[model samples]
Every structure is written in structure tokens, then in C-alpha cells.
Target: SFDVGGKEAPKVQLTKDGKEVKFTSVEGTRHVYSIAEVKPEHQGVYKLTAKNKTSSEETTVTLNVTGMYIIQ
Candidate 1:
């Protein structure tokens, strides 16, 4: 999850391994991103970017999947 610290609402974008990916945004939330039902193929470097009229912010995270199966 990420937070936006600007006056205006920013456009959020999420990417995995340099490719654009889909994320879930719940209603009434500011800037929350979620990936449901994670799988082994989902392991990669994820980058999130939020840009508004005045400023922009971004972050990166790495997802590593190990073991037989993920419970949740």
C-alpha cells in the first residue's frame, strides 16, 4: 500500500518487472493497491508511481516466492 501526500488526487500506476500490471483499489481509500491470490509467477520487482498535477512519487519492492505453496 502507498500514500499520496498532495492536495489533488494522483493517478496511480503499478508495474511488475517493468511491465504494467493490474491492482485493486477499494472505494473510499486514498491510495491503496492490492494484488489478490498471489501465485508463484507473480514474483518479481514491483514499482508503484503516483503522479498529480504538482508532484510525483514512486517506490519499488521485490517479491520473492519460496517453498511449496503460499497459504494466503
Candidate 2:
């Protein structure tokens, strides 16, 4: 979790490969909020952030989701 001023930090927006995933009811969620939707296509280092109207963070994370084997 993060704390930011109401009019300081960015409203923060999350997405996966350009898909919008709203994390908050606020707007201007740019490099502020840590937002992303993990999907089968999302296999690699992802960006994680948290922002408000004040300040934001920039980080990276690896997403690993196992899948069932498909037998012939």
C-alpha cells in the first residue's frame, strides 16, 4: 500500500500490454500507481508502481503462472 496527497500524487492507472485496469476511482494515474493485469500473455518482468498526486515508484517483478499439461 502507498500514501499520497490528494492533489499531489498521480491518480495511477494499471494495465496489461495496453489494456486498461482501473485500480482507483481517481484520475491521472500515470507513473504513480502500480497497476497491471497478469495474464497468459504477461510472461516476463512487469512494472509495479504506486502513485498519488505527490510521488510515485518504479519497480519490476516477474510473473509466473503454472499451467496444466495437455496430454495427447
Candidate 3:
């Protein structure tokens, strides 16, 4: 989620591994990105960019998929 204060809402873009990713929701100044199921291929870097007429800001996150375990 992100906050870009003011009347006009900023445009939010999310990318995963250099490819554009779909956003789940965008309410007010908040943006949400959701992946239904996480897989090995889904493990990578993610970037979020918030832009407006005036200024823009960005952030990056890295996700590592070491292993998955099921408890019986």
C-alpha cells in the first residue's frame, strides 16, 4: 500500500522481474498487489512505482523461494 497525498490520485504500477504485474486493488492513495499462488517462477524482484503530474517515487522488494514444506 502507498500514500500519495493530495486531491488527484497518483498512478500506481507494479512489476515483477521486469514484467508488469496486475494490481488487485487501488483505493484512494493505497495500492494492493496480490498473487493468488506463489510458485518457484514467482520468486524474484518486485518493484512498485507511484507517479503523478508533479513527482514520482519507487520501491523494490526481493522474494526468495528457498523451499516449501507440508506438515502432516
Candidate 4:
């Protein structure tokens, strides 16, 4: 989740491993992104960017998913 405050709302975008990704967004006082389910394929570096006419900002996070282990 992120808080965006400025004279004008910036355009928000999310990407995975440099590729655009589709996600559910809840916009209000705060911006929240949601992914219903997570799988191995979903693990990657994610980037979030907010851009406006005046300026732009961005952040990145790395997601690592390990395989489940079972014991007898």
C-alpha cells in the first residue's frame, strides 16, 4: 500500500521483471494492490511507479517463493 499526495494524482503502474502485470487495485485514501493467489511463477522482482507531469518516483521489491516440502 502507498499514499499519494500532490496537486494532481500521479499515474500509478506496477510491473514484474520489467513486464507489466495486472492486479486488483483499491483506491481511496491509500492505494492497495492485491493478488488473489500466489504461485511459483509469480515470484520475481516487482516495480511500482508513480508519475505525474511534474515529477516521478518509483520503488522495487523482490519476491522469492520456495517449493513446499513434505515429510513422511
Off by over 4 Å in 4: none
Task: Please give, for residues 1-72, the per-residue lDDT of candidate 1 as tens digits.
Answer: 665555787788889999988766635435565657777898999998888988888899999977685688
In model 4, which range of ten residues has the least summed lDDT?
Answer: 22-31
What TM-score, computed on C-alpha atoms, does each candidate reach?
A: 0.72, 0.36, 0.76, 0.83
For all candidates, what are the clash counts?
Answer: 0, 14, 0, 0
Once model 1 is optimally superposed onto the true structure by TM-score, how far is the C-alpha of residue 42 displaced, in angstroms?
Answer: 0.7
lDDT of 4 by residue, 1-72 (tens): 777667788888789999987646646536676666788998999998889899999999899989889998
lDDT of 3: 0.80
* Structure candidate 4, residue pairs in collision: none
Residue pairs with clashing backbones, model 1: none
Which is the winner by lDDT between candidate 2 and candidate 4?
4
Lowest-lDDT window of 10 residues in candidate 1? 26-35
Sequence-dependent TM-score of model 3:
0.76
The whole-model lDDT of each prediction reads 0.77, 0.51, 0.80, 0.81
Error of 2 at 61 (Å): 2.3
Cα lDDT tens digits for candidate 2, 28-70? 3323333366456656554545576557765555667667699
Across 1-72, the per-residue lDDT of candidate 3 in tens digits comes to: 555565556777899989999878877776777778887888999998877888888899999877778999
Judged by TM-score, which candidate is best? Answer: 4
Q: Per-prediction RMSD in angstroms?
A: 4.1, 6.3, 2.4, 1.6
Superposed Cα deviation of residue 17, candidate 3 (Å): 1.2
